[model samples]
Target: MSNCKKISLSQILLLVLDIILILGVITTVIVYYNTFFKGSGNLNGLNKFIMFALLTVGITCIFFIILELRKIVLTLIKGNPFVWLNVKALKRISLECFIIASCYIVNFIVNFGENKYKFIYLDSKGIHTDTEPIIFILAGVFIAILANVFKTAIEYKEENDFTI
Candidate 1:
């Protein structure tokens, strides 16, 4: 569509992402406060280590994802969405997703014996599941494949430019 429309859509998306990232940071700070300052020694060393690691990696990935999305949106605003740099950004975002997914799996395995899997919640009220990491893994693979498609498209566009 028009440049204005493209920027408007991306700007909306960027706003939403910014809000989510802010909320995530706030939640993470609250969690850390409750887990350490007010934990009353309920959490062990290993659990604390894992929690910190998970949050660090998760937040880092989120930051990188937002950066990559900003790059893509900027390209869209410039009327050039299929560029080599966008491909690299997409690839990096995909790798970040995989890394986050692996962290979740590691956390699950580390807590398997303690019956306290962070990804799978089991409470007296009911059984709640957090399969977000798995979904992210799948999304990562899909995005990686999409990046390849973008690479091919870029190559084709270059060839067309040369022909013209």
Candidate 2:
């Protein structure tokens, strides 16, 4: 096998994605702090619910961002070509997608009707109850498939390397 370790286009893409993900996490944190911690009056019942949702989604995104950073670090340290096609990487991607979906669901719940306060604190609770579970289930399914794909890709690459 050739010993060349030239950086590939895909590595560049992954690096860029990782940077963007980190920046996104930072932005989310800033927003959360500004909204929740800075002298904002106590979020009332419905506002509290919405704040919790945002916090949950933000935390999830931060976790995924950290995972992506780990993957990037591992790829650089190991000097591997297909590092991003690994189980850990897939898990991170799945988690990121799930966080995004959850954010959309929360946004929908918070803005569902003409009266913004109608769904607060159990009033019209059904309005906020439909989509999150389904989205979470779908995210779980995607994560499983992503894991399998990663394993298969890694195995295929190994087989090809052996053949050559």
TM-scores of all predicted structures: 0.82, 0.51
Residues 1-164 of candidate 2 have per-residue lDDT tens digits of 99999886656776777777778778877877876777557676787678767777756775675566567555655667364446766676666767666676676667678344332344444434345546665975677696777677888988999999
Count of clashes in candidate 2: 0
lDDT of 1 by residue, 1-164 (tens): 55653337877877877787788789878877886778737567778788778878977897889878888888886789999999999999999999889888877887778866555676898988879778989989999999999999999999999999
Which candidate number has the best TM-score?
Answer: 1
Q: Report how far residue 95 has shifted in candidate 1, in Å.
A: 0.6
Question: What local distance difference test score does each model get?
Answer: 0.84, 0.67
Instruction: Kindly report which residue pairs in candidate 2 clash with one another.
Output: none
Candidate 2 Cα errors over 4 Å, as ranges: 1-29, 39-43, 83-85, 115-149, 160-164
lDDT of 2 at 6: 87
Model 2 worst lDDT run, 10 consecutive residues: 114-123
